[model samples]
Target: MTNKPAQATLLPDNIAALTAYSSAKSEKISGNTWLNANESPYTKEACIEIRALNRYPDPQPQVVIDAYSTYASVDSDQVIMTRGADEGIELLVRTYCEPAKDRISLFLPTYGMYKVTADTHNVQINSLSQDLLLNGEVKDIINAVSGSKLVFICNPNNPTGAVTSVEKIAELTKSLANKAIVVVDEAYIEFSESYSCALLIKDFDNLVVLRTLSKAFALAGLRTGFMLGAKNTLAPVRKVIAPYPVSTVVAQIAANALCSDAITQMRRQVVILNKAKATLIDWLEQSPAVSKILSGEGNFVTLQLKDKALLTLATNTGLIMRPFKLYNQDNWLRISIGNEQELKSVKDWLNAISAQV
Candidate 1:
């Protein structure tokens, strides 16, 4: 008896075509220079004192929930903690979208997780070009999202760093009332001046906001993130979440980070990153090697390069940056805002390369 082929017999077709998310650390390059991921170069001492690691942590850690709620200016009941903003994206698909039935709509050149998670659950994806979203046209967005059950908008959008104004988002959500659930991902909002749509949840019951401590709060290793919505809007997600969503150690650290002093420190760091981002943008704008620099409000900047040779030069110099081949935006690269020294080194390396040519 011949055995069936594993790919043909076991794996689902949707997953078979799926390309896994390649995180910056996935490169496995060991080096003194690290800037591929948009993580804080600074880290604080954990000083974690958890009562128990052997036993299971709280199914819903009150302190962690309370900390994030206060930080996001939402009530605890409006918050649900997940492994990271990534998991929150998954939970939204699992809880609301029916496999092979409900569809999710989002713009291109945005975060990869929104599409990846939606694809994993076998949900149909209606991808809209960024032209409409970037222009902030509500009617175009409404037309684009006509049949989608879940609409995902990444504010201070990734890769492009383009931000949709809070007022524009409010208008979109208002128009889509009862038509679809509006999810605003604010993963990079801390670096932007735009207000969070979490403030609009009260007005729009269907509005859901996703946030992560990974970026501005500098808690990437902890894998902490949040989902904010009205109680009824989040009810389904709460029902399907992991028994103990967050570890005790993580909860302790997250709570500490939420304290007033730490928050102030986080803000100060954001100011520094914004400065670095602006400097880098200014330098890139002047460089003859750059074709165009995309507008964004995140700690990173994306630029269309004249060629891939610059990427090779950066890599050869032990500098790591993200290339957008997977996003189908070839020849485009995202450079995360690192410490002052790191930014200077990268700028010097670019200048040296330009001088060689």
Candidate 2:
């Protein structure tokens, strides 16, 4: 009898090497203040009527498609709802990129999901600095990502809150037309509405804009997101997507949230959060503990701490915030905009630390 090979050896090399995406703590932890995930502290009550628990939902629910398209000002055909923007990223990669052959491009220090998804599919990544796009070096960016299958741009960039101009994105899409699918992730667009690249989808067949209800709509639990582009651009993605991407209950709740009244309420909440973000910035600015305020947009504030010990201090005090290392800078920290009481707690902690100094 031939000797049996180890079970682990059956796993693909790429799968063996891949590191899973690190998500924020979902279970209850030993922290009173949770401000790590960049989630809205405000929760909107969703009234979902129970129905159709047995049958599978539509692959692309028309209600969600219509609602999101109407809100995004795109035709219904241009949208495909996914589990979240995360799934949209996966679908785009699976649809466009051939494992170990076709590659995707990403501007670093943006969303982690883009890289994670690319890696999971055994797709090669052409990593470029965020500065190339931020500085409007469109020609260089185009040249660097030449022949890539997809290029992802995260606007009002996560963890940094850096906003890339619409003009730069338009220039990129036009320059790389037919060469690569240019994906603009507007996950935080509602916080910086003027900088969205969604409108340019009509102009560029290669451009795909990703929008999520998790940030502004306060529906992270719903796991709903949309991809906006020319209908043809999204056609291939639909073929790769799961049979039933959105569940019946999630569809109803997301549809209701996309309504005009809910949108208005969402906008009002955004205004309030922006104001709270401003307050947090003011506090951070005054705190001697903060070395520099890196960014203040998209419902979170990122900063460089004067002392890295402050992170440990916050953790010991039951204050949980996100720690980041951008371009080898290890002192970076991100704080999500929580409610008034949460903000006050953060402020007090900063004050205490500053007083020690």
Best by lDDT: 2
Clashing pairs in 1: 161-296
Q: Per-model C-alpha lDDT, please?
A: 0.86, 0.87
Q: lDDT tens string, model 2, 138-220? A: 78888899979899999888878988889988998999887888999999999989998888988999999998989888988
Per-residue lDDT of 196 in model 2: 89
- Residue 269's lDDT in candidate 2: 93
How close is every model to the real structure, measured as TM-score?
0.95, 0.96
